[model samples]
Target: MSEKSRFEYVREGAKTRDGVDIVYYEPNLPPGSKAERRMVRLVAFMLLLSGLAALIFVAAYIWWPFTDFPATDGWEYKPGNSFMKGYTPILGLSLGLALFLIGFAVLIWGKKLMPHEIALQDRHDGGSDPEERKLTGNTLAFIGEEFGLGRRPLLKVALLAPAAGLGAAALAVPVGMLIKDPHNPDELFRTGWSPEANGGKMVRMMREDMTPIRPEDVSIGGQITAFPMTADGLGATNKYADSPVLLIRLRPKDAEFLRSQLHHHPVNVGGMYGDLVAYSKICTHAGCPASLYEQQTNLLLCPCHQSQFKITENARPVFGPASRRLPMLPIELDGEGYLVARNDFNGVPVGPAFWEKPAA
Candidate 1:
């Protein structure tokens, strides 16, 4: 069919705000039909549901009980374990529902309310004519000559100054982050067991209940989860996830073997106080708790990814994906006979390596 015949049914409508001509094609069905009204109501209902979900998402984000609660304490929201337990799921569900409803509504509106029509525009084969190109170039050159940028160096510099300053300001934001140390970098390498935390006094190794752990507390071929006795009493809390350590007491022969192979380990052999040694419970692979300890094999296993650390070999990664050895907290008997940290885990940073982490 000819192009003129193809558009014969199209009616010219009012011009748009931009002066573009509006064209209407004949609808397959008459307007204001019961089916069309039902579709309109369905689309409107979906859009309204989407708006309600979006509003709920914002409200939940602002007013949801996200306050941190101690493991021992209870909150009004009944945020079992931590206040963030239910926070993330609710936010995700509301936002996801809003987005899904919006997208589905748009799809339904297009399929049901809007008509499918084909439109065509005339195609050009080549660039503008030589005369048009020359005229355009002359116009631009005339504008440039009138501006007198070449004659006015100071004006040009003044114009460029703001752009240069803006570019510099944009560049400075990220560069400033690199130079600024908001918190101490040493904090990443040190744990709550740092000797300096307790007025230069040795920080005692304590259980989750805040009771000091004696050498007799951890039996041979057994492991006990321990935390540093901090001044603020942040033991076993989410605030101190990096502070948990597995205090494994090796058999005498196993301890002797580990002592003999101390040269292979990253930290000094003194990190072990007799047969009892404490290693960071955080897995080096992905920061999961390496809590699943096997007494017979003397391996601390991370349930998340199966990363195993040899308890009798300075907690070295003997199996799974872990590349670095578990950081060993230096321990010794305090004056009162309870186990205490001589110092923080050597100089190495704990957990997974990140972009800002220094090279080993």
Candidate 2:
């Protein structure tokens, strides 16, 4: 037959269902051609692979070890923490592959098995006629009547209870955070270095290995990261992020300078332990570790934002975005000569100040 006649034949052979016309642009395959069979297998294989990937995603999400495992410096991939390190990447790959394969399978099925054709439909620009609107409203009313809600008041009340409860539950999901306090405001102002945290006695400063640091342990013009040596014997790890303090043994000239600065600002001297001063390692601006010490310049720098704190001037912010000084941990030598916190930070909260923090 001619191309025009064949096209006409195909269009005429189209069917309609539920007021919608269904057109097919291609004829059915004769028995089973190898090419058509291969296409079918390829599409099925893609769909099966997609399903397998989805199942793997679900399994990994549920069974993978995602807990904080022992690793050097918190996040490095060591043999002990390899599973934890790979958990997130595996989840992303599995889920992404599942979604990608499903879409690919649909594309292949359409291109290989289905015919390409344009659908035509009559379009009306304005709102539906009054008759159609009336019919739609009547249909909705009939559905409501079929529910028998008006006639059965008790059933309607029961249904309303679930709807109201569900709505409240949905609202609570977002509103719950505002209502709840995740961390205590009072606790935020305190740390493991506080005297109360160590059985109402002085808390000793220790190294990362939990050994108590004596004044002699730190050399002049050098800084050592210290933590509160609590009764638990877990100095740094016990309090983790909040308890680290920079113990700087200043040179005689710098110490004299700091003493001079203290005379003018007595509150800044509250945490000074003579020549060996202790300050919070956390930055006041963004809470990045302000631990990069420049012994020559007497400056403590936060690597994250280049915030400079002059160690001689009460760890005061000398440059960058930091607006406040690093809160000093009140230090003194105990009876045994171990460097210890004399008291909690003199009323000033450490780290980044929030709206709840009182104005300095």
Candidate 3:
């Protein structure tokens, strides 16, 4: 049997040598009719709408109004905190509409103006023949020789230099980021809790508004989350995210139970209130702000993953994945009888165990 000719097989049902079938069509129109001209106008209109959408996309990219608060200083805009919080949504809508309009316009254009047809062809299997493979290989080899890179060492070096320089440029950006050490042992680890910062002065615990907390302010079965009071006696900045303490005023009986259980570092300071103790609010497992406190059960629940820490006895992890006990922030009273953070966490790392903190 003879092989089929590689040339054009048919005018209407043409199939290429690669076996890809192509079906051609020409739209029929009425003689000098204005209605046919209207169809052409409709096609142009769809295309024009697409062009307008493209222009709007570019304009939105250039000057769509948006506001971003500075990370260093920010308003405490929590959810449902204030109005005019639709800044994020507006930017999303404008960019989304711009893209959607462009796509819709193009789809409408194709449906209105273009003719559709179907064709079938037999699939070709396996690689090219030996002659074709050799031709391709020789073509590449000839091109390489034409460049004279094999003879001219200078040209070879020149071409290689740019590629090496580009690779180094790519590596330099990531290296620059890692060059500055984030784990500055002196600054990052230490806070105002250090005795040196306070000049032998004990640090007082303050509220979010810099109000000095008193034992009377917190109810006997309630808990108030507190931060380390700075030297200037102000609310702590973002630096003290790990320094949040849960000031819990337990019942007299429960306080006695804790003090007896913890013999070395007793919970009672001056034996006045008899049961107020402070522990780090951050979960040791994942560093989540463990704020969901249960007044009735004395079980502090982590809202994130339900890691329960008992508030009565040293904030010990009783249930869930959390392993380490919450760090106790040693507290004392100021001259005015307000609760204060005496020192930092008692050598206990606040967060998850990494390579730095080896397992015991």
Candidate 4:
């Protein structure tokens, strides 16, 4: 007689697959039973919950207001739009429910609707025989059948729809971030220090208390957090968050060393007012506030990543994760003797670098 087909051999010998010996196997409610049909419908409905969740995530991510400011193209929303107040919670709940529902559906399918079987396999080494390989392939098909893959179309389609949606939701996050930043591209290159932001007048560096800071206000070997008066003084730290600066009062000797450094860029030439100089408080590494100033070592430290900038060397990174020098806010004294920025950060954008960021 011709050799039996692999599936037929396995099916005829015992209800075994691969090398496993089935000592016992039983179906819960028998094939196509009325009660079993109800279980399949229930599992199918539960599995579909994940698909609905995926739709919620994708819709909210695309259509919902996630930014306080309106788009450059002038979307109808007002500045400080509060619609996105629920953005984080919505995304969290939708994505979380999708993950949980998919898992729960699979668990219910396994424990409630699937066949119960006990099988034992003898130890084997290396690759299985050709017959065993065919048996293994058939075994997977058999398991799918037990899950109603062939006999029930509803269960098979139910699993596929949610899987595709979950994948799309996963991809939307990173792709959406790459689309645009907090605002327009031009906004990234300008700050409150820019003359345009101040009705074309130079911006005076003022303290957080909204008081204009004179050179005398900052003592030697000390620093103060400052903001452009045009940026509503320090209140702009909320609107123009990147406008905050670390205004330092270096020792006369340290100031001299900085000006004398031959390799120092021309931006630092008139960037100082006597022994006082200012740098963007935002770290170029990850935009953390590089606020911890070490007057003893003349170094500026970023508490977030420990990135250090040598104040005596034009705030260039001398240690840690930062590579780019902190952008100097070219400062000088106005006729009234209040410190003012010469221009917006010497043509370099402040804070962390982006792919489109121009070189100094």
Best by lDDT: 4
Tens digit of per-residue lDDT, candidate 4, span 85-165: 577789899989998888888897788777787777777688877976776777678767655578789988998768877
What would the per-residue lDDT of candidate 1 be over residues 1-360, giving only the tens digit for each residue?
Answer: 655531232222112111223244444334557776676566666666666666665555544442353322212345445555776687678768877876786687567555554444344577756764665465445434432334224434433433343344335333433333324456446677886666677798898899999999988888889988887787567656787888888899988888887877646567888888788888988999888988778888999989888877777788899888888888899889999988888876788853354332
Please give the range of 10 consecutive residues that has the lowest summed lDDT in model 3: 65-74
Cand. 2 TM to true fold? 0.51
Model 4: residues >4 Å from true position, as ranges?
1-184, 231-236, 260-270, 346-349, 352-360
Give the local distance difference test score of model 4.
0.78
> lDDT per residue, candidate 2, 1-360, as tens digits?
646753343334332211113343342332146765676566556656665665665555443432343211222345666557676687678667766766786676566655454555355587766865665465445434432233224433333333443344345322333233334335556778877668889999888777888988989888899988877665677345677988999999898888888755466665677788888998988988898999999999999999999988888788999988787777888899898898877777788844455343
Candidate 3, residue 94: Cα displacement in angstroms equals 29
lDDT of 3 by residue, 175-245 (tens): 32233332333333455554544566677777888777898889888888787677645346764566777
**Candidate 3 residue-wise lDDT at 161:** 32
C-alpha local distance difference test of each model: 0.67, 0.67, 0.57, 0.78
Worst 10 residues of 2 by lDDT: 13-22
* RMSD, one per candidate, in order: 14.0, 13.8, 14.0, 6.1
How does candidate 1 score on lDDT? 0.67
For model 4 the local lDDT of residue 142 reads: 72
Give the backbone clash total of model 4.
0
Model 3 residue 320 distance off true place after TM-score fit, in angstroms:
1.6
Off by over 4 Å in 2: 1-185, 238-240, 357-360
- In Å, residue 212's CA in model 1 sits off its true spot by 0.4
